[model samples]
Target: MLLAALFLLSACKTEPANQGFCGIIPKRLEAAMSYGTSLYLGSMPDQEFLREDQGRSLRQIPPLEVREDPMAVQAVTRGRCAFSIFEESFASEQKELQGLKSAQLLYGYPDSVVFRMYVNPAALRGEEARTRTLDFLDTLWSDEFQSKLEFYGLKPVPEGLRTQVRNDLPGFLTTASESE
Candidate 1:
């Protein structure tokens, strides 16, 4: 009886191990540029935003453009944006952006900001893993996570500034990366 109880206890205590890639966002101009671009292109009223808006409600306005630029990515949500870090010409502009501490100020707008990073999703057991990864991203965008980001140096972008930057995403990403 004692041995059976011990075995059951140990089995119940077993937990899954963390197995995934460990990525790093290099503190450089490229990262900053990518972040900025994402902020510009990913904000609400952007293409993706319009699509979601249309899907949810019939009165949404169509976006001016349907296709994203080949060189950029965006978030198009209230929480975050997607920016690319691997542009080829980003190495040359490092000198021009020396004093820009945060990507938020690079655009000369106080309310909007860009985010950059290297994310390693946990080792997924199957197709469901992808879904899990997206769920994890949702948590990152939660208000609780945003507060933590502010503590680290990133600032939350306001809705109005987000609209203004949506048109200049590619250039912003390229410039920021080069400056890095």
Candidate 2:
């Protein structure tokens, strides 16, 4: 039993380091999976440093717990890649990439599937905003969004936005802030 336990622990080692700030994602220093539903990354750079073949992960933070579901958190910056496609279209197509006007997307990985929803009490109000949010999420889960994720290498695409988790965004931000 002791030997079996040891083997199991060893077997749980994380994936080989391939995803980094300048690798799969342009902002690649390192992207990590956390105990909670969030993955944190850092070492942002300016646009001048951005190069080709680099991209960001789009994995949404998972839920920490049922109680953590309603807390809206801001977007976490993994790294600054001026070349990242997000930056390229950030202003021109912000609404197209984001599900909620109050919520934003990040570059993530395949193992950490992102199914996130955010509600901003200030910006998101009234029937119009609510309707937009629902429509955005629905469109996010559609084939188009999943394909977008696949291109960025964030896979195991979520079934839908019904799996919204609130604590993840906060958790990711905390990780990024503390590490800095």
Candidate 3:
């Protein structure tokens, strides 16, 4: 009986989902000119946004090729594409990696890529696990982590967005937990 109870307690112990969650990392992409004569989009989100805005705010621009961000940078570095959309942080990092010297920022866009905290579905299975997961999610926004965002080529979530996410997180957490 003692051994069975110990086994049950051990099996019930919930560990924090440190590796199962993703931290929020806000990043924006910039349209950069390199060597090609035509424009291109590196990320799917940018392509989708441009497509949606084609008839409205971006009527003057034509449809462009869509490629992975790294491939877009490579194409520009290799002089295959004239311009490409690159995340601000990735642009700087890739320039150094590709030994690119002539890439120029053509236009700045609003924050379009913001990663949100996502806890593993398995972590929301029980009350203790849910609490631990929620606590872990909150720590992602701590000052220490926020301070390191720039170093990782990410921007801190703005206060407004932070508040919005904070307001919405509990509902999401509760829903996820209840669903389990």
Count of clashing residue pairs in every prediction: 7, 16, 2
Q: Tell me the lDDT of model 3 at 55.
A: 42
Per-residue alpha-carbon lDDT of candidate 3 for residues 90-144, written as tens digits (9 for 90 to 100): 5555543343222221222235543322222333334544454444444444444
Error of 1 at 55 (Å): 42
Sequence-dependent TM-score of model 1: 0.27
Best by TM-score: 3
lDDT of model 3 at position 90? 55
Off by over 4 Å in 3: 1-112, 118-123, 176-180
lDDT tens digits, residue span 1-180, model 2: 111101111111222111111111122211211100111112233233232212323112111111111111122112110011132223333343243222233334534323333332222223343333333333433444444454444543344432342223322222222446
Ranking by TM-score: 3, 2, 1
Q: Which sequence of candidate numbers ranks them by lDDT, best first?
A: 3, 1, 2
- Reference-based lDDT, each prediction: 0.28, 0.25, 0.34
Best lDDT among the predictions, by candidate number: 3
Evaluate model 2: give its lDDT.
0.25
Residue 173's lDDT in candidate 1:
28
Deviation of model 3 at 110, angstroms: 10
